[model samples]
Target: MAVLQVEKVSKWYGKHCALNEVSLEVPEKGIFGLLGPNGAGKTSLIRIINQITGPDSGRIFFRGEPLKPEHVNHIGYLPEERGLYRKMKVGEQCLYLARLKGLSSADAKARLKEWFERFEIGSWWDKKVEELSKGMAQKVQFITTVLHQPGFIILDEPFSGFDPINTNLIRKEIIRLKDEGASIMLSTHNMASVEEICSHIALINQSKVMLDGEIKEVRSRFKESIFELSFKGQMLSFTNALGTQFELLQHSSDADLRLARVKIKQGLTVNDLLQRAIPHVQIESVSEYIPSMNDIFIKVVEQPEEQMV
Candidate 1:
């Protein structure tokens, strides 16, 4: 079942339209990526989802029920722009925020302790927020955001301030949360992370959803019939064998081994290409090349709006 569903939701700010009939579904117990370039209305949609503002048109549903005010308590949000009370101690701030999420003081404290230790930042608990580095503060904010054990979590640019180690740490935590039955919506420009973590994604551009689907399905939908071949043989023999059956897009040689990327001709399959090349080259490996999320994002965003769908 979908954890969240948006139906033709639109939002406008005076003369400017921030979201134009946007619609997408975030499935239950998995990570959903909300992707778009800056100024593409990602933040606007997020705001509407969080109830920071109402949509000018259309409707949203949470688990089949119309979204309402009480739903806020079941949703946790960590925005792109980090906010914290610099004067407040890290533990103090976490406790306050946790309570606001409806946790008892004692429960909040216990959860905070567990989170701090898990993040290896227990030593910073008594320190003021101002004393912590940007990354450290980010970790604290993340703990509080999920402290109340909300069923759904919205994280925008969650990896913004972390180093590679911390980034991986957060990535693992996100996966763990999903395994524990929490639906997560992740918004970030980091396509590599999205490819690694997102089960599904929606790409928005010019205030509209250009594409949305399961990651593998989307990649297959845009695949260009390209394949990579690794073989030990003369490059000339391989190219000559390919002839009209394939278009050699790229080729390289290292010692006795050679590699080539070729696009199979229409009506020709991988087996066809293999049969044709096997006689000329000693085939080591053959794998189809799938476009990365980064490539798909660029291609979709650059296409004309009318062609995006």
Candidate 2:
């Protein structure tokens, strides 16, 4: 089921078209990745969904109803640009944001304590926001953003400033949040994270939705029928075995084991590739090479204007 849907939304900045008749859906549960390169109008669409700005055309629905100002309380957003007050104490600032999100003062304090402890930032509670390092400030913002436990969450570049350990900690928390019944929208350039956590995604390019669907399905849709193999074989014999049935895209040798990628000929299955290789090479293992999200992102967004959506 969909938690949020944007229908034919369009936003124009003066004469600049940021978003052009774009539509997207956020699932009822699990992470939905909002993917696109810079200047693709992802942020514009996000703002419209959050009601930070109104679209010049189309509509947005949340839980099957028209999105309204009150719905903002049920949604939590962490913007790419951090917005904590520099002079406020970490704990105080979090409480203020929580109150703004409609949390009671007592409840905000309790949740803030729990989050600070979990994030191992309890000692920084009294530090001024300006005194904290960038990553530290990021941590405080991250905690406050989700402290109210909203059902719908939008996180933009949620991992941008953290070290590797903290990044993993946040990643784990995001997965946990989804498992605990919260749906999330992850907007960023992190293709690897999208692959790891996003169950669904909508790829916008040149101000249009070029692709949209479950992650696995999207990857499969762009498959080029390539396969990777690992084996100990003579390069010459391997080439000869392939004959005209396969096209070698890449090959490399590591000691005795040879790694290569080939495009399967039409009407040929993976079994065919293995069948032809067994006679001439030791076929240790083989697997289909599905293109990564990064590959698809670059491929779609960089194409000629006539090719992109």
Candidate 3:
């Protein structure tokens, strides 16, 4: 079941439309990537989901019920811009935030301690928020946001201030949260991270959803039947064996093996290409080239609005 459903939601600021009929569904227990470049209206859609702002048009449903203000307790949001009382002690501030989320004081303390230790930042509990570096401060904010263990999470640029190690640490925790049955909507420009954790994704451009689907399905649809073949043979014989069913796009030699990228002809399959080449060349490996999310994002965004899906 989808935990959150947005139907033709739109928002605007006076003469400028920030979002135009954006619709998407976040599933119950997996990470869904809200992908778009800067100024693509990602922030607008996220605000509507969090109830921080209302859509000028369209509706949102949370687990089949109409979205309401009180449902904020059911979600944990880590905004792109981090905010915490500068002079507040990390531990004290975390406890306050957790209690605000409806946790008992005792439960909040226990959860905060567990997370602090796990993240190895327990020593900073009594330290002032301003004393910590940007990355450390982000860690505290992250802890407080997730301490309540909400059923759904909205993380906007969650990896921004972290170094590589912390980035990986947060990535692992995101996966753990999903495994524990929390639905996550991750908004970021890091295509590598999206490919790592996102089960599904929706690409937005100019306030419209350009594409949306399971990651594998989207990649397959964008793939143009290109395959990278690794084999050892005379280059001429290999090209001649291809006949007219395939076009050799590019080829290069790495040591003794020759690697070539070939596009299959219409009405032909990888097996057909193999059948033609196996007799003339020694086939070592054959793998279909699937476009990455970054590739798809670039290609899709470059197309005219009328051509987008």
Candidate 4:
């Protein structure tokens, strides 16, 4: 079941259309990457989902039912712009937010203890938010965001201010939450993170969805029939062997290792290229060059609207 569904949702501010018939689904227990360039309506859509703002037209459903104010309790949102009472104690702040989500004071305290321990921030309980570093404070906010164990979580730039270790830690926690049956909507410009943790993605551009699908399927859709070849033999021999069966788009060499990117002609297979090249060059590896999410994002966002498929 989809944890959240947006159907032909449109939102306008003055004369500016923020979301134009934007529609997408956040699958249950999976991480959905919400991708788009800055000011591309990503924030607008997120706002509507969180009910911070309402759509001007269309509808939103939460688990097959019309979204209502009560549905807010089932959602946990960590926006890109993090906020916390700077003078408040870390544990106190977390407990307060937990209760706001409908948890009783006792339940909230118990849950906060477990989460604080799990995050190894038990010692930070008494520290003021202002006393902590940006990353430290971020960790506190993250714990509170998921403390209530909401079924659906929306995280925007969740890894911001995190170092490599902290980033990986959060990434693992995200996957763990999904494994435990929580659905997540991850919004960020960090394509590497999206590629690593997202099961599906929806790309928004110019107030519209330019692309949406499973991660692998989306990447596959942008493939150019190009392959990367790494060999230890002469580049000239490799090129000569390929002949017209493949077009060598670019090549480079480092030490004895030579790498070349080639696009196979129509009807020609990888086996066909290997069959011809085997006699001339010692093949180390050959793999298809799949475009990364970053590449696809730039391509989709920059391409003329009419040219998109």
Candidate 5:
């Protein structure tokens, strides 16, 4: 089931197009990655989804119905920019935001107490927002965003100011939320995060969506049919064995072993490469070289505009 759909969406700032004919469907109960470099119109599209602004030409749907004003109540948005009140006490601010989301006073307090305890920040409830460090403040804001139990959540750069431990904490919480049936749209430049949590992704570049699909499918689509092999043997013998079926992309020496990155031609498999080289070398490890999301991001974004066309 799709929780959100954008059809032929386009946005413009004066005569300059910010998003052009972009369309994507986000599945229910899954994390969808909205990725791109700076000035790629990702924020424009996100703003349209949040109804902060209207699209120049397009339509959006939520839960199979036309997106309406009331849908905003069902969304919990954490924009890249933090918006906490500097002078407001932590507990007070959380209760206020919860009330704004339609929670009763008593219910808001109960939920805030639980979240504060779970996040291990209960002792800081009375502290002013300004008294907290950036990561600490981020935790408070994150708790407030999810306090109302919104059906759809949008997190923009959710891990921006955290150390590794806190980053992992947020990651675990995100997974837990998805497991509990909340759909999320995660917008970030962190490709590793996308790889770790996203079920599917839509890659937008220069106002256009260049790619969209399941993570594994997208990686396979861009695979170069390469493999990395580690072995202990004469490099010349191994290279000589691989005459035409494979091309050696790189060769390097680790302390006592030879490492070779080889690309096989189409229709050739790892078995073929192994068969040819195993006779001459003692193979320690043989693994396919699938490009990481970071590598794919650079390759796609750096492509010429005409090629993307």
Candidate 6:
């Protein structure tokens, strides 16, 4: 089931088009990655979803109903740009934001206490927001964002200022939230994080969605049918036997081992390539080279015209 849907959404700033006919569906209880390079209109689309701005053309839906002011209560948004009152104490600020999200005073306090304890920041509650480091301040903002238990959450560059340890901490919390039935949309340039945490993704470029699907399906769509083969053998005989069935993209040799990256030609399988080479070389291991998310990101963004063609 989809928790949020953007249908033919378009947004403009003055005469510049920020988003053009953008559309995507975020399913419930899954992490959806909104991926793109800088100035790709991702932020514009996010702002529209948050109701921070209106779309020039198109509509949005929340849980199958038209998005409205009341639906804001069902959303917890942590924008890329951090916003918190510098003079306000951590606990007080959190409580204030929680109430704004429709939580009662008593309930807000109870939830704040629990989150503070879980985050090991109980002592920092009384500290002013300005006195805390960026990461600590981010923790406070994160706690307040989720304190009301909103059904949908949008995190833009959530790992920006954290160290590896804290980054992992938040990543685990995101997975936990999904498990407990919260749908999340993660917007970031970090392909590693997307690969590790996202179940589905939509890649946007030039103010339009270039690709969108489950992670595995999208990855499979970009595969190049290349394989890495490690073996101990004579390179010439091996290359000779395989002939044109497989194109050796790269070849290197050491004292006793030979490593070659081969691309399987059309109508040729790994088994067929192996059959031709088995009589000449000792095969140690063979594995396909599946493109990583980072590789795919660079490839897609670098060839926008080719993708459209």
Ranked by TM-score, the better of candidates 1 and 3 is: 1
lDDT of each: 0.93, 0.91, 0.92, 0.92, 0.93, 0.91
Question: For every model in order, what is the number of clashing pairs?
Answer: 0, 0, 0, 0, 0, 0
- Report the error of model 1 at residue 138, Å: 0.8
Better of 4 and 6 by TM-score: 4
Over 1-309, each residue of candidate 5 has an lDDT whose tens digit, in order, gives 799999999999989999999999999999999999999998899899999999989899999998898888899999998779999998899999998888899999998888888998999989999999999999998998899999999999999999999999999999999999999999999999999999999999999999999999999888888999999999999999999889999999988799999999999899999999999999999998889999989999999877752
Misplaced by over 4 Å in model 6 are 234-242, 250-258
lDDT of 3 at 253: 90
Error of 4 at 206 (Å): 1.0
Worst 10 residues of 4 by lDDT: 237-246
TM-score of every candidate relative to the true structure: 0.95, 0.96, 0.94, 0.95, 0.95, 0.94
Better candidate by lDDT, 3 or 6: 3
Better TM-score candidate (2, 5): 2
User: Mind giving the per-residue lDDT tens digits that candidate 3 earns over 38-139?
Assistant: 999999898988888999999999999999987888899999977899999989999999888889999999998899899999899899988989989988
Measure candidate 2: CA RMSD: 1.5
Give the per-residue lDDT digits (tens) of candidate 6, residues 1-309: 799999999988898999999999998999999999999999999999999999999999999999999888899999999879999988899988999999999999998899999999999988999999988888888888888999999999999999999999999999999999999999998899999999999999889898898999888888788999989989998899888778999999977999999999988788998898899999999999888888888888889466453
Which scores greater on lDDT, model 1 or model 2? 1
Higher-scoring candidate on lDDT, 2 or 4? 4
Worst 10-residue lDDT window for candidate 2 reads: 300-309
lDDT tens digits by residue: candidate 1, 219-277: 99999899999999889999999988799999999898899999998898999999999
Task: Give RMSD to native, each candidate.
Answer: 1.5, 1.5, 1.7, 1.5, 1.7, 1.8
lDDT tens per residue, model 2, 52-95: 99999999999999999999999999998767899988888898
Q: Give the Å shift of residue 19 in candidate 2.
A: 0.8
